[model samples]
Target: MKPANKFRADTIRRLIVFLFLFSAAIVGFGCSQPILESNECIEARDPVKRFYSFHFGNEMLASKENIEKRKKYLSKRLNAELNDRSDTKFDYFTQTADYPKAFRAGKCDSTAGDRVKFEVLLFWRTNEKNSQRAIQVEMVKENSRWLIDRVESKE
Candidate 1:
């Protein structure tokens, strides 16, 4: 019945509601997008979806099988570099965030069906929310397929 306790309870309730809403939005996003599973895209488009996996949080793309299409145009270092950065660890994250209006942006590259460039705004929280908007990736078309050429963003 203290004022501070009431405020804390209200805050916690709001946070819980926000988390539920956020989770529903993410699930809706996954179901709504036309983008196929990462591997299917890679096999059909070959190199295009590998980097797509990188920027958008797909794990299966770091394999040699997915990257083989790049060997002709890109150096061996490309695969090695991506492989090195690939995280096989299963980390857990909580959605202590509000859904961002500009969290991600991209267009399907007109030249290639599977290539997409994403300008993503990533949020990180320590105690307070911090947001940064940056060009996360530019997936390009080569040899009639798509591949992520770079992933970079400025906060």
Candidate 2:
């Protein structure tokens, strides 16, 4: 083979290898990218999670002061209704007098207009026994912010 032709062949082979590596890198980068959640889902899910974190961390008490502290996460009507409850023994949010030790908010469902629902799991630890309950949390987008509208037992 001629020297010039051999040089051209070597260059072509290197170029092919480089192009294959570049294409593989591009494909690998694309696949490794994280899947992003929709803004609406984030907006809907964050407030619920934040509220539960605050609630559980605050000794799971739903007193008037605690309710007032978390008023930002509550709807106007719900806040008013909760405030009106004279008996602090019964927690309106958890719908139980005996509160759970912790809670987790599930995925947000935004099929309803301006409303999202989350399946919240409530956990209780008592005397080496553990119990859990599922509740449906309904939130409404009010004034461009998501707020807890209502809670119902899934049972």
lDDT string, candidate 1, 1-155, tens digits: 99999999999999999999999999999788575445423443334334333424532233454345444434343445655654423211111123222233333333345445444344444456666544444455556554455555443
Residue pairs whose backbone atoms clash in candidate 1: 48-146, 48-147
Segments of candidate 1 deviating more than 4 angstroms: 1-77, 80-103, 106-117
Instruction: Indicate the TM-score of model 2.
Output: 0.75
State each candidate's clash count. Answer: 2, 0
Could you tell me every candidate's TM-score relative to the true structure?
0.32, 0.75
Candidate 2 residue 134 C-alpha distance from true site, Å? 1.2
Best by lDDT: 2
Instruction: Name the top TM-score candidate.
Output: 2
| Decoy 1 TM-score against native | 0.32
User: Relative to the unseen true structure, what is the Cα RMSD of model 2?
Assistant: 3.3
